[model samples]
Target: MKMADEGRRGEEDGGPGAVHQVFVVMESLLEKLKVLNYEEEILAKHNMKNLSRHYFVSSPFLAVNPGEQFFLFTVIAAWLINEAGRPFTAPQEHDEPNATVSNILSELRAFGVKVDFPPSKLKSGQESSPNYPAETTEEESVIEDDAELTLSKVEEEMIEEPDDEEENVMDLEALKLRTCPTDTEASSKPEEILEATVDAAEWSLEVERVLPQLKVTVRTDNKSYLDRLQEDVGKTLEKAKERYQQASGGVTERTRVLAEISEELEKVKQEMEEKGSSMSDGAPVVKIKQSLTKLKQEIIQMDVRIGVVEHTLLQAKLKEKSNMTRDMNATNLPEPATGPFA
Candidate 1:
C-alpha cells in the first residue's frame, strides 16, 4: 500500500504533466502555422507515417504513438529552426542535389518536411573568425589562491590566539553585558526554540491526517475539474478563431464590393464630364446620374459595415488573448504535481 501510494505520488509530481508539456509546446507552434492555414502542408512535408491530417492538433498527446510523436517533434524542430534562421546546417556530406541554405531542410524531408525558406544574412561587417577568446593564466590563479589561503590562515590565528595582556583587558561593565546567559536562561532558550517545534509537530500531524484525503482529491476532483476546464477553453478558442476568420472574410468581401462601386461611380462621373453639354437631356446621362448616386450610398454603407466588422474582429482577438492567458494560468500548474499514472 505504501509503495502504491508513493508510486502514485511520483506520477503526480512529474509524470503526466511533464509528458503534456511537450504537447503544449508543439501545439503553440502548430497553432501559429494553423493561423496561416498551412498546418496540412506541414504534416504532408513530414510525411507522417499513420497520423491523419491535423491529428496532432485535434487529439490528445497520449493517443499518439511514440514513434509518430518522435517524428512530429523532429519535424516541428526542423520547421522552427528554419523559421528562426538557425545558424547550423547539415554536414556537407548530407547535402542532396543542391548545396545551399536549404540543405538542412532536405535532411528532414524523409520525415515529412514542409517549406524551406532560407533567411537572408547581413553582408556588412561580417567576419571570418571571432576576434577574441578568453585566456586565463595558471600563475595568476595560483597567486590568487595562495593569497586567499594566507588571509584565511592569518584570520584563523588572530581568532585562535589570546591577545597581549593590555589588548585583552576589557571594561567590567561591557564584559557583564557581553557574557552569555546562565543555565536557567539557556534552558529557557531551548524552550523558546521548542515553541516553534511544537507548532511544526502539530502541523505535521495534521498533514498526516489530511494526506489521504488530499490524494483522493488530486486523483479525482482536481483532475476532472481541470480536464473539463481545458476542454471548454479549447472549444472557446476554436470558435473565436473561426469567428475571426469569418469577420475577416466579411471585411474583404465588403471592400471588394466597395471598390467595384467606386470604380463604376468614377466611370459615370467621367461620362458626365465628357458629355456635359451634349447629353443635358439624354436618357443615358440621367441613368448614369442615378447609378452614381446609388453607388455612393452603397459604398458608404459598405465602409460602415467594414469598420464594424474590423472593430468586432479586434475585440475577438483581445478576448481570445485574455482567455488564453487565464486558461494557461489556471491549468498550467507547477509541473510538480504527482500523478498515479504516468
Candidate 2:
C-alpha cells in the first residue's frame, strides 16, 4: 500500500511542464512571423524540419531532430541569426539547395536574436570573424562541469528524499478500515498532484496526436521572396514617409486655423470690453435686463432643485410607511432577545 502511494506521488510531482512551454514557443513563432510579408513560393517550401536542420547544422553545440516540436526554440535562435543580415554560420554541409542564405538570416531576425557587432567595424561595414566558434569558451567547460554537478545533486535529492509517513501506515484490511483523517489528507494531496501530472500527460498525448498532422508547412526559399518582402517593406516605408509629410502639412494648416481662431476670439473679447465700458457709463435699463435674465435662470434652477428635494422626501416617506407597516404586521411572532429579529 505504501509502495503504491509512493509511486503515485512520484508520478505526480516528477512530471515536467514541457507541453505548455512548447505551445508558448510555437505561439511566439507565429506572432513573430505575422508581420513578415513572405512570397508565396518561399512560404510553400518552408517546413519546421528544414528550419531545424538549418539551425542545428549551424550551431556546433546544438543537435536537434528536425521532426520534433521541442526544437522550436533552437529553430527560433537560428532564424534570429539570419534576420539581422549576418552571414550564415551553420556548417556548409547542412545547407540545402532550396535554403537561401537569407532565409536562415531572416528567421533569426524574426526571432529577435541580437548579434553583438563592434561599433567601429559596423560603421566601416567591415565584417570580423568571431574568435570563438559558436559561443564556446574554456570557462564554458567549467560551467558544463558545474551543470553536471547540479544535475547529480538533483538526482541525489530525488533518490534520498524521505517518503510521506501516511503512505506507510496503510490499513491491512483496506476495504474494512474507515477513512482516517491522515489518510484523507494524504489522498487529497495526491488528487491535486495528480491533476498537474495528468495535465502534462494529456498535453504530451495531444502533441503526439497533432505532430503527425502538421504537414510540413513549407516556407519560401526563393530569392524573390526575400526581395518581395524587402520591396514591400520599402514601399511601406515610402508610404509612411508620404503620410508623415501629409501629416506635417496638415499640422501647419491646423496651426494657421488655430491662429485665425485666436485672432477672432481676441476681436470678440475687445468688442465685449468696449461694450462693457459703454454700459459702465450708467445705462440702468441694460443692467436691469441682465439682472432679470440671471434672476430667471436662478429661478429655473431653484424650481428643479425643489422638485428633486420633494421627490426625495416622498420616497423617504414611502419607505418609512412600508417599514412601519412591516413592523406592525410582524407582531404576535416569536420574539428573540436580540433587537429587530428578521
The prediction achieving the highest TM-score against the true structure is 2
At residue 215, give the lDDT of candidate 2: 41
C-alpha displacement of 150 in model 2, angstroms? 42
Cα RMSDs of all predictions?
55.6, 46.2
Question: Candidate 2 on 185-291: residue-level lDDT in tens?
Answer: 54666444334344664455345434434445455578989899999999999999999999999999999999999999999999999999987777788788999
lDDT of 1 by residue, 172-212 (tens): 44433333212455456643433434466445534443443
The list of candidate 1 runs beyond 4 A from truth reads: 1-220, 277-342
Q: Which stretches of candidate 2 lie over 4 Å from their true place?
A: 1-219, 283-342
Model number with the top lDDT: 1
lDDT of each: 0.45, 0.44
Give the CA lDDT, 0 to 100, for residue 211 in model 1.
42
**Model 2, clash count?**
20
